[model samples]
Target: MSSVESVEEFRAEFRGWLRAHLTGGFADLRGRGGPGREHEAFAGRLAWERHMAEHGWTCVGWPVEYGGRGASTAQQIAFHEEYALADAPARVNHIGEQLLGPTLIAHGTDEQKRRFLPPVRAVEELWCQGYSEPDAGSDLAGVRTRAALRDGRWTVDGQKTWTSLAHEAQWCFVLARTTPGSRRHAGLSYLLVPMDQPGVQVRPITQLTGTSEFNEVFFDGARTDAAHVVGAPGDGWAVAMATLGYERGVSTLGQQVGFRRELEALAALARANGALADPLIADRLTRAWTGLQAMRAAALRPGTAPSTAKLYWARWHRDLGELAMDVCGAASLTAAGVHGDPYEPDDWQRLFLFSRADTLYAGSDEIQRNIVAERILGLPKEVRA
Candidate 1:
C-alpha cells in the first residue's frame, strides 16, 4: 500500500529536511589561487550535491523503484522553486540526473538500467552528453563521428566539440554513425562510451570568461562492448530527440526558477542602490523577470512542442548578460574569485558567458522556432536544400 502524501504535503516534508541539511548559499568566491580554487569549488559543489542526494531530493522526480522518493511533478517544481528561492548551489551531477538518467531509463535495456541507475543516483558515476560535434551543431544528422562494430565490440573514432564537462565526467552518452555511406540521419547509433579508457583525449576550451568549462573530445579506436549500445542501432535520432524533449520539459524548470530568483535579486540590488530611477535599468530588470516567468509556465506544459525553453533561455540569458553588465557596470565584468559586491556574482558571469550556448545547445533558437513552425503551426519547411 503506497501511503504518499499530496504534493503540497510532500513539499512541506521535503522543505523541512532541506532546512535541516542544506546549508549555505552564494558565499562562494571561487576559492583561492590556481588548482586550489577549482578543487575547492568542485568540493563545495559536490558536497552540496551529496547533501541533496543523501536526503533523496536530488532525484525527487524519479520513482521509488529507482532510488527516488516518488515525488510528484508539482512536488518536484515546488522543491526546485524553493531551492532556488533559498539560492542552493549548482549540483555537480545535474547532467546525470536531468539528461542522461531519463534517457537511459526510457531507452536503456534492463542490464543498462541495472548497471547505470544506482551509481547515477549515488553520484558514483558522472555523465556528460557527447553530442554537438563541430559540423553537427544544429544539423545533428551531419555527425561524422564513426562507431563501427568488429569482433563483437564497437570501435569509435571522431572529434566532439563544445562538449561540456567531459574532463570532469567518467562516461559520455555519445551518438555516432555506425553504417558508412549512410548520410544524414540514417544508420546512426547511441552508445554509452567509457572515457577513462585509452585513445580518448579531452582538451578544454577556454570561454570568454577564461574559464575552461567546455572541451573538445577526440576518440580514436575507443572500444566498447556491443552491450553498451542503447536502443536499436541507427535509432540515435529518436533517442536523442526524446532526450532533448525531456531536457526542455523537466530540466528547464529548475533553471528558469533559478534565473527568476536571480532576476529578483538583481531587482533588489537595483532597488537597494537607487538604480531603478533610470528607466533603462528598470526596464531590463522587468523584462528579464517576465521572460523567466513565461519560460516557467511553458516548462510546465505536458507535451513538449519542438519550440523548447532552452532556446528561450539562451536568448534571455544573453539579454540579461548585457543588462547585468549595464546595471552592474565595471564590477560584473571583472574576473571571478574576487569578493567585493553581492550583485556582481561570478556564477552570473559564468552563466552569462556560458549563456552564449543558451541558444546554441539543445538545438539552436532558430531550429527550435522552425520546429514550432513546422510541427505546431503546420507550416512547410522553407529551405529547398
Candidate 2:
C-alpha cells in the first residue's frame, strides 16, 4: 500500500481500538497525566500500557523482529496524533520506546538489542534517563558521574538531578565518566544501570504543582554488568547524542496534539468565565492558535527542525500558561480544592507553574540557540570558560 493509505488505515484502526478500550476506569484517565501531573493514576496507566503491549500497540515504530509492528514514520505519527485526540493516559514507557529504543537500534550491539528491546517493547521494564547532573543540567558534556570497571561490573558514583520518574523506574540509561581524567564529552560511557540496587537512592523533588514526578538520584557504588555498555566504552558522547536526536523525533507530533487540546480547553474556559469579552484576551487566544499551526508546520521540516521545534513549542506553551492565568484572573490565585487541604494546584495552575521549566530541561533555551547557531547556521562557537 501507498504510505498515505497505510497511515490512514493505521489511524482508523488505532482510533477504533482506543474508543473501544477507553471505557470504565480507563475512560476516566483522559487528560489525567503528562508533564506536571505524571503522578496521576500511576498503577492504572502502567496496566493500560502493558495492555497496549499485549495488543501490539506499544513501540509501533520499531522493527517487527523486535516486537514492534515495523511502522513507517507516517504511521507512527498517525498513532501518536490519534492517541492524543483520544485523550489517552500519558505513556510511561516513552523514555524507553521513543528515546533509548532507537538509540540502541542505531548503535547498540546485537546482544544488547536482544536483551533490552523485548522488555522495553513489552512495557515490562520501565527506564529513566540519567543524563543531567546537579552541576551539568544543560551542559550535558560536563557530567561528573563516574563509572569504574571492576572485576566483571561497572561501579557508578555520582548524583543525577531532574531525573524524571527515577523513583518508579526499574532501570536507568546513565552517561557517566569512564576514564578517570576525561573532560567535557570525552571518556564517557552510556551504561544501563539497574535502579533496584542497594547503592541507588532516589529522592523525589516536589515541584510547584505539589507533585514529585522529578527526582534526585544518588548512585553510590551502584553496579551494572560490564556487558551493559552501549557502543565503545569511551565513545558514549556519540551514543548519547544519537539518543538526544531520537528524543526530538516524530513523537513530537503527538505532543503538539496535546498542546492543541490544552489551547482549545483554555479558549473554552475563557468563554465560560466571560474572559473572551476582553479584546486583548481574544487576540491572545487567536495568536496562540496561529502559533500552534506554525509549530506544526515547522515540525514537518527536515534537519534542524527538532531544535527549532523544541524552542518554538517550549516558549509557546509557557506563554499559553500565562494566557490561561490571565483568563482565569482572580480565581487562579486560590487553590482549586479546599483551602486547608495540602495546596493542590488545578489544571491551569499546574500548567502555569510547571511550564516555567520548559525552556530549562532537555536542553535549555540558550543551549538550543547555541546548537542552532553553531551547528545549523554555521556560526562561530561560543567561548567556553
Candidate 3:
C-alpha cells in the first residue's frame, strides 16, 4: 500500500478499536480526565490505559526493539488524533511514553533502556518530570537541586515544585547539579529517581480548579543507582532540552484535536445560549476558529520553531478561556455544581479557571518569547544581572 493508504488504514484501525472497546464498562469514562479534570475517575482512567497497553496501544512511536510497534510519524499522529476523536480518557502514561521514553531512546545507555522501557510501554510504572523548582521555574539554569555521586549511588536533595502527577508517579526524571560549585546549567546530570523512597515526599497543590494535579516534591538525600543517569554528568542541559523538544512535538497534533473539540463545543454553546447574537462575541469566535486553523498549520509546517508554536498556542488557549467566561456572561461567576460536589465547576467555568495557567506552565510565555527572539530571530540575548 502507498503511504497515504497506510495512514488511512491505520486511522481506520484505531477508530474501529476505540468504537468497539469504549463501551459497557468504559462507556462512562469518555471525557473523564484531562487538564483540571485529572482528578476525575483516576482509577478508571489508569485501568483503561493499562487495558490499551495490553492490546498493544501504548507506546506506538518507540522503536520495535524497545517494545513499541515502531510506528511511523504519520501513523503515530493518526493514533493520537483518532484517540482524541474517540474521546478516550486522558492518557495516564504520557510523561513516560512521550517524554522520558523518547529521551531514553536518544541518550540513555543500553542497560538503562533495557531496565526502564518495558515498564513504561506496559504502563506498569508511571513517571513525572522533576524540573521547575520554586526558585528555578523557567530559569532552569538556576536549579539548586544537588546530587552527589557516592559508592555506586547518587544521593539527591532538593525540591521540585509544579510537578504534575508526582503524587501518582512511581519515578521522576530529575535534573540536578552534580558538581559542588557548578552554576548556570553546568555540571548538571539528569537522573532517574524512584518516588517511593523514604527520602521522597509528594505534596499535592490544590489549584483554581480545586484539584491537585500538580505537586511539590521534596527530596532529602534520595538515592538512585549511578547507572540511572541519562547522559554524561555535565551534559544534562542538552538532554533536558531534548526532552522539551519532544514536549512540543508531534503529540501536539493530538492536543490540537482536543482544542478543536473545545472550540466546536463552545460555538454550539453560543448558539444555544444566544451568545452568538452578540457581534463582538461572534467575531471573537470566528477569530478563534481561524486561529485554530493556523495553529494546526504551524504544527505541520517544516522548519517551524517550537518556541513560536508554543507561544501562539499558549496565548490562544488562554484567550479562549477568557472568551469562554465572557460567553457565559454573569453566570460564569457562580459554580453550576453539575457534578455532585457543590464546588465542582461546569465545563466552561473549569476551562476558564484551568487555562489561566496555560501561559505559565510548560516553560512560560516569557521564556518562550525569549527563545524565539534570541534563537529564531537572531536577536541579541537579553542582559542578566
Candidate 4:
C-alpha cells in the first residue's frame, strides 16, 4: 500500500483480504492457535500464515524494502484490530517477525538484514528467544550461558529454559557471555545460532495446560558464525533489551481484541449459567470491560511506558481467568475428556491454568514494577546484594 493511504483504507483492505482468503482451507484455522491453544492445527496455521505472507500481509509494520508495507503506527493498529475482528488464527512466527526481525533491522549489519529479514518476512524461517535461563529468568543480566569465540565461530554451551517454540524454530538469538569471568550485564554477546544442529537439543516443558508450547533448550557447544553477533561483541544487554522492547510493540492491539472476545464470551457464559445474577460477578465483569478500555487508551497514548502496559495487561488477563473460573463455579473444578484422554480441561479451566503464568512470563510482575519504578517513576534503583 502507498504510504499516503489512510488507516481506514488499510483496515478495509486487510479486512477484505482476510474475508476473501480466510476460507475453506483456512476457515477451520480461525481462532485455532493462541495462548494455551498453540498446539491446535499447527501445520494448518503455518500454511495460513505463509499464505498471508504471499499476499504482502505479513510484517505489515516493517519497512517495505524488507518485504513489508512500511505501515504507519495507526495503520498497524488498524491491521491488528481488523485481524482480531476477523477471528484469524494466531500467528506462528511472531518471535521471528516481532522480536528478532526488528532487532536485526535496528542493530544488524547489512548482510544480516539481507540474509535474515526476507525469511522472517516470508515466514520461511522460525526463531526463538534464548534470553531466559533456568536460574536467570527475570534477572536477565545474570545470564550464565557462555559463548567462546574459537576458530572463526562462537561455541555456545548452556541451557535456556522457557524457550517459546524452540522445538519449531530454525534459529535462536541467544544472549551468551563472550568475555570470560564477566558478571551480570557485562561482556555478553547476542549470537544467532541454528537450532537444527546436533549440538542443540530442545526438550519440551509441559505447561499447566497439558501442552508444551515452550521448552528447555540445551546448547551443548552450539556453533554459529562469528559474524552472526548483533551489535558490538560484549554489548548484548542493549540489544537484548531492544528485542524485548519490540516484543511489546504494535501487535498488542490485536491481543486486546482477543482479550475483549474472551471477556464477552465470559459474560455470555455467566448469563447462561446464571452467574451474572450475582452482584459480585456482574460488578467484576463491568470492571473488566472498563479496564480493557483503559488498556486500549494506554496503548494509543504516546510515551506510555512499555512496562506499564505489560504490567497492566498481564495482571488483568490473569484476573480475567480467575473471574472466568468464578463464573463457572463448580464446573471449573472438573476436567472434561474427549477421545479417551483422562485429563482434558474445558475452556474456562484452560484459561485459568494458562493465565497463571501471565504475570510470570515475558517479564514477571516484580520485574515490571521495578522497571516502572526506576525508569518512569524516577525511583532509586534496587541495590544488588
Could you say which candidate leads in lDDT?
4
Tell me the lDDT of model 3 at 62: 84
What are the lDDT figures for the candidates, one per model?
A: 0.75, 0.91, 0.92, 0.93
Q: What lDDT does candidate 1 reach at residue 255?
A: 66
- Show where candidate 2 strays beyond 4 Å: 1-5, 338-342
Comparing candidate 1 with candidate 4, which one achieves the higher TM-score? Answer: 4
Instruction: Evaluate model 1: give its lDDT.
Output: 0.75
| Candidate 1 wrongly placed segments (more than 4 Å) | 1-3, 24-40, 304-306, 330-351
Q: Which stretches of candidate 4 lie over 4 Å from their true place?
A: none
Candidate 4 — worst ten consecutive residues by lDDT sum?
333-342
Give the Å shift of residue 373 in candidate 2: 0.9
- For this target, which candidate reaches the highest TM-score against the unseen true structure? 4
lDDT per residue for candidate 3 within 225-285, as digits (tens), equals 9999999998999999999999888888999999999999999989999999999999999
* Candidate 1 structure quality by residue, lDDT tens digits, 208-244: 6566767899999998889999889998889988777
Q: What lDDT is reached at residue 374 by model 4? A: 94
- The global Cα lDDT (0 to 1) of model 3 is 0.92
Instruction: Please give the lDDT score at residue 160 for candidate 4.
Output: 97
lDDT measured at residue 384 in model 2 versus the true structure, 0 to 100: 98
Query: What lDDT does candidate 3 reach at residue 301?
Result: 87
Candidate 2 residue-wise lDDT, 100-162, digit = tens: 899989888999999999999888899999999989999999999999999999999999999
Ranking by TM-score: 4, 3, 2, 1
TM-scores, in order shown?
0.88, 0.97, 0.98, 0.99
Which residue pairs collide in model 3, if any? none
